[model samples]
Target: MPFAASLASAAQQAQAAAGAAGVRIETVEDPERLFAVSRLLAEVWATPPGHDPLASDVLRSLAHAGGAVHVAFGPGGMTGATAAVFGPPRGHDLYSLIAGAKQGGRGVGYALKLAQRSWALERGVATISWTFDPLVRRNAWFNLVKLGAHAAEYTPDFYGPLDDGFNTGDRTDRLTAVWHLNRLGTPAADIADRPDPDAAPGPDGLPFTARDGRSLWCRVPEDIVAVRGADPARAVAWRTAVQDVLAPALADGYAATSMTRDGWYRLTRP
Candidate 1:
């Protein structure tokens, strides 16, 4: 199929998925709806007293300027939201700035993303890009496995210091993801043939670094949030270790291809 037709087909599939999940997704143009989105972001990310990342005015401006500020509603009111900024004209991509959901809101995040994709496709954008913390295992699964997005770049401390609930003490390293609206199957299908990494501990009860061919395996703590609370130094150690492994590998043209259920990042040379 041609690129535009394929993208349209993908968008239809996404809309179907959202409908099956029974969530109402909407673009926030009204001031009241935009404020609700801002409040949702504040509550979901647990922004500190004065550090709301997406204030009502910011969301309104983005929406008014042809960008997407989508909100998802469930039985319990607003459940999830996503915001994206348009890239430069030459880039032909939408940069998804942030997405978050209320805790325990199953399927809310996925539905919101489907809505974002559908909205972008209707506007003729074929690619959607976003940055995410590589250490978050569940996010890795959602972005790479479930949504069929690929990591294109890795940056160290991309946001300096994030004082939000999930990113309080950690350096803000992130993986930039590129989701091709016209080619969803390719990314998810590529995972099956890759070699698996061993997460077993070595002699010192520390996780072993494993590799295969041109691929390097890296690990994050199973529960980084709990680990950070119990042992800040250890959490930092994981951060530094991941940065050491991923930064150089990505710089050398290796991409994070797949993540294991046990939190291993498989960085492989193309």
Candidate 2:
């Protein structure tokens, strides 16, 4: 099936899947109109108040690639959206995971995933990566615990300053996760074989260092970023930063044999 047809078919299926959710899914073609969408998305993402939506370079990039952007419309009005870039199976490539205040729990996001799956399956794209606020356990459960993605690394201040409902006191700490779209059938079984995430870090943690004073992994991702970005006087301090980019390494054959309860995860390759 051609890519466009695949998207349309997936979208139709998604519309059916949304059954009575009063949600409609469709591809967004007007890049310029995204200014309005960006404002909504920024609000949904909880970017600080008064955020500059015009600085949305990422959205521009997606449009440039001719990526498929889907928005979910509920009876009330706009609910949410998801976007993906279709490409052949390859590393060093990524997709975005942006959801809005859609009424249904994960409905729009699920629709977007199905659409991406269709595109990926047709193009032989094996993996897809996206970033989400780590502190948001809901996203974690949905993306990693449920969808089988993992935290590869911690990106400090993924986006700088501005306004969002959730970023008031902390800079957004994000985790990058992948969806092995080419995998046949449900990925639940495959997830069973993967190791678990590390336990939460503690005060008695080991000293972690990055290139210029960032933690080796992440400590209260949102908090640390807030500290780091908040005051130049108070340098960011944490037990972990500069994580080993676990998911990619693991997907590339590395394995997590064990994770300490004290928040340390050990990985090995077979």
Candidate 3:
């Protein structure tokens, strides 16, 4: 599709998605609304009282300087929020810094992402990039399968250590997702082959290895957050296992193409 037509279609799709999710998307500019976004995100991340992920003053500066701070409002109240800024100099991509939705709202996060896509396309940006924890299965599915984005890089310890409720006491290994706005499509089909258990056993007894020369399969914990809380040592082991598998594959020119709901990351070499 041509750029203009594609952008229009994306906008319409974003609108329909928000409607289906039973939410309203808005770009808030004023201080009060921006502060609301900050508070909402803080709650979403379960940050400490004085440790908001993004401060309201910083959000305001970004908004005034051509960045975006979008909030999703449902009947109850704000259900989700996302903040993004333009990429490096001379780059035509938008980098989503943070996004989160309250629990129990079906499709709220998806709708927020579609909204971000439309927002980026409208401003002549063809790509939107973000980093997500590689150990999170649901996030892998959401970004790669649901949104049709591709994992472009494997970054070990991307954020060092985070004190947020979701990320404390864990290595912040990340997969950088690059969504090609114009090429959005349906969810990816399922992969048939399973990871070979004999290839290599990780610390947690999970398999992580390349099957054949062209593809690799890595496993993630079913619920990393719960594992972190229940057994912090096991959580660290899972993190190291995934990093041992994915980091080397990505470094060797393999891209994570699709992830299964059962927690398998399928990577393919170019």
Candidate 4:
């Protein structure tokens, strides 16, 4: 099937599910609704991190100005969601990556992100940032290689003691990734248009521009299955290898933003 048609079919399913539940996954136009979304995040990805879905504050912050959030619901509750708040101080929104079991797989996350992309593009925003646990190879492919987002290495313990949702006291290392939300297609294709470290900045004024950013970055774990062993030698090897790629990019100006709690990878160069 053609890409456009396939996308449309998936969207139809999402919308149909929404209608069945009398729920919509768009921005919170009302303040109370915004609070409701934060509450949902706690419920969906945090509490059962396991507990009640109404126990999160991370969802609340995304409601402020220059912010945006999306929520999905089923017969009893929300299925899954993706939220981001655009800005500088918080690396332009690299918050949570919580998906409910009812969501199934990438289809839901992809749809939510596409919605976020559409919202940002309409506003002249060029990028969307987020973090993910890097240990999971699936996210590495989805966020960096597949989505055309780049990654950056961040210091360990990036978010000191994160025990909620998917994170549970291991290594807090992460990689920050960016979806050139505005140029999702062109940049991911045509290598000539893509950022080449040697080239000058674009008219849009981005990294390698006056702001000083790296062109692109990412990491694929050398050994996927046994990466998190407690062996000190293996630990050093993993840390060193990941840091080498991310550190240079950071020193060159890429900063870590979103992180994957399940995999321990952080998206950077934001």
Quick one: best TM-score, which candidate? 3
lDDT of all predictions: 0.79, 0.51, 0.86, 0.50
* Model 4 TM-score on a 0 to 1 scale: 0.56
Candidate 2 lDDT tens digits, 94-183: 466465554344466665566555554555456777777654434554665445555555565677654655554455555566666533
**How far off is residue 22 in model 4, in Å?**
13
- RMSD of candidates 1 onward, in order: 2.7, 7.8, 1.5, 10.6
Clashes of each: 0, 15, 0, 29
TM-score of each: 0.90, 0.59, 0.95, 0.56
Off by over 4 Å in 4: 1-24, 29-36, 43-61, 74-77, 89-106, 185-241, 244-270
Q: What TM-score does structure 2 among the candidates reach?
A: 0.59
lDDT by residue for model 1 over 118-235, one digit each (tens)? 7887778878999988878888878877787778698889999888888898898899988887655334323344455457653225764677777777766677777778888877
Candidate 3 residue-wise lDDT at 222: 82
Higher-scoring candidate on TM-score, 2 or 3: 3
Candidate 2 all-Cα RMSD: 7.8
User: In model 2, where do residues sit more than 4 Å from their true spots?
Assistant: 1-16, 31-33, 48-61, 86-94, 103-106, 160-162, 184-270
Could you tell me the lDDT of residue 13 within candidate 1?
73
RMSD (CA, angstroms), candidate 1: 2.7
> What residue pairs clash in candidate 1, if any at all?
none
Worst 10-residue lDDT window, candidate 1? 185-194
Best by lDDT: 3
Deviation in angstroms for 60 in model 1?
0.7
Residues 1-270 of candidate 3: C-alpha lDDT, one tens digit per residue: 777889889999999999999999998889998888899999999999989999999999998989998889999999999999999977899999999999988889888989989988888898899999998888888888888888959888898989999899988888999888877654453556653555577666756554656677777888899999999999998888788778887888889888776777888875
Say what the RMSD of model 4 is.
10.6
